[model samples]
Target: MKSRRAILAELFLTAASLMALFPLAWMVSVSLMPPHDAVGFPPPLWPSHPTLANYRELFAHQNMGRYVLNSLIVASLATVLSLAFNVAAGYAFAKLRFAGRDRIFRGLLAALIIPGQLSMLPLFFLMKELGLLNSYGGVVVPFMASLFGIFLVRQYALGLPDEMLQAARVDGASEVQIFLKIVLPNLRPIMVTLGVFTFLSAWNDFLWPLIVLSHDQLYTLPLAVASLSREHVQDSAMVMAGAVVTTAPVLVLFLALQRHYVRGLLAGSVKG
Candidate 1:
């Protein structure tokens, strides 16, 4: 009876998992259907005749490739820059002796509770003043350094031995050498985790990019998809194709790096 019940429970969970993934499966199905077939009264589970016309139309006519490139550029730049800044600051807070370090770090932690939206208006004005509005620089600037990234790095860095740093110093290794050679290599797993997090956040960011970037040519995938959905409400297949394109890369990245990401999250939570 116990074995039977366990088997039944596993079957039930499998059904639930399929149900959760059904929307995505359906979207892909619909995206391959011929233009008008997606919204039929009795929806088709699979396209009778799968077609890549939607994807072709997206790239050729709508110039979705540009949007993809924009998303890639902004997200990658933000990830790289944020990692550099956060790791340095976090290591300093974790190991370096300095006056008021704890107090300042605490203040930063407190500030993290403040919603990013509260700064949007002022941030926009600041970007405009610096002539960064409607440019990639504007989209990438606000995310160059993040509080969460710093916190994550600091938590990870705190586990390192102080004796290692002292030894490095005794060997005449400068602080920069110590950080670049010794510390950064040890921090790789967390860095990969942070990079994935930062990339996803920047890629999916809609509101800030929407507010700052006015040019269609500069539209990121999320922005372009939203705009496309508005204008092409009738084209369900095409819209789903756009969504697939927008979501696929990030989904792939997550699936590949999820172990490291989860490890980093657990490490930060336990330590912090």
Candidate 2:
């Protein structure tokens, strides 16, 4: 009976996986289909005649490559800057002795309760004042530190043996040296998870980029895809191709880092 139940569970899981992934598969299939094939009768699941025309058009005319590059730059910058800032802040909160540190952290957590949309107008005004609007700095600056990222890191770091930091201090190690040599190595799982989260969030960001970036050249993949959709509404296959392009990088990144992400989540939750 146990063996039978195990097989049944496996079967159920397999079906659920297929159900979740079917749309992605369909999107790729449609992208490969010839023009008008994606929107054809019965909504064909597979391409009758596969062609690279949609992808070719995107690269050749739509300036998709430039958009992809823009996204890469934005995402990479956001991830690196956020990682550095959040790790330091989190470690400070977890280990350092400072007045009102807990109060300040609680204030940050309270800020998270406020809807982000409510602040956009003020944020935009602030950006304009700083002369960062319509620039890469505009997009990258706002995401460089997130409360959730800091919280995640703090939670993970809290479980790290305090003795290590004390020993490093006793040995006359500086704060920077301790963080680099001891804390960072121990926080590997959380770092990978946070890095992946930041990268994907920045890569997939559309609303902020659209609001901040006015020039066509600064358009990210999601913005470019939206433009493509409006301009080529009838070209379903082309739109699908754009979706694939916008989604593929993050998908690959997540899959590659899936183990680290899961490990980080488990460690952060269970350790502390």
Query: Per-prediction RMSD in angstroms?
Result: 1.9, 2.5
Report the lDDT tens digits of candidate 2 across residue range 1-272: 56988999999999999999999998898889888677754357888899999999899988988999999999999999999999999889998989999899888877867776787888899999999988888998768888778888988788988898999999999999999999999988788899988888899988888899989899999999998888877788988999999998889998999987676667446522
Q: Model 1's lDDT to the true fold?
A: 0.89
Tell how far residue 9 is off in model 1, in angstroms.
3.7
Which portions of model 2 miss their true places by more than 4 Å? Answer: 1-12, 36-43, 263-272
> For candidate 2, what is the total of clashing residue pairs?
0
lDDT of 2: 0.87
Q: How much is 19 displaced in model 2, in angstroms?
A: 2.3
Candidate lDDT scores, in order, read 0.89, 0.87
Using lDDT as the measure, the top candidate is 1
Candidate 1 — which residues are off by over 4 angstroms?
Answer: 1-5, 39-43, 267-272
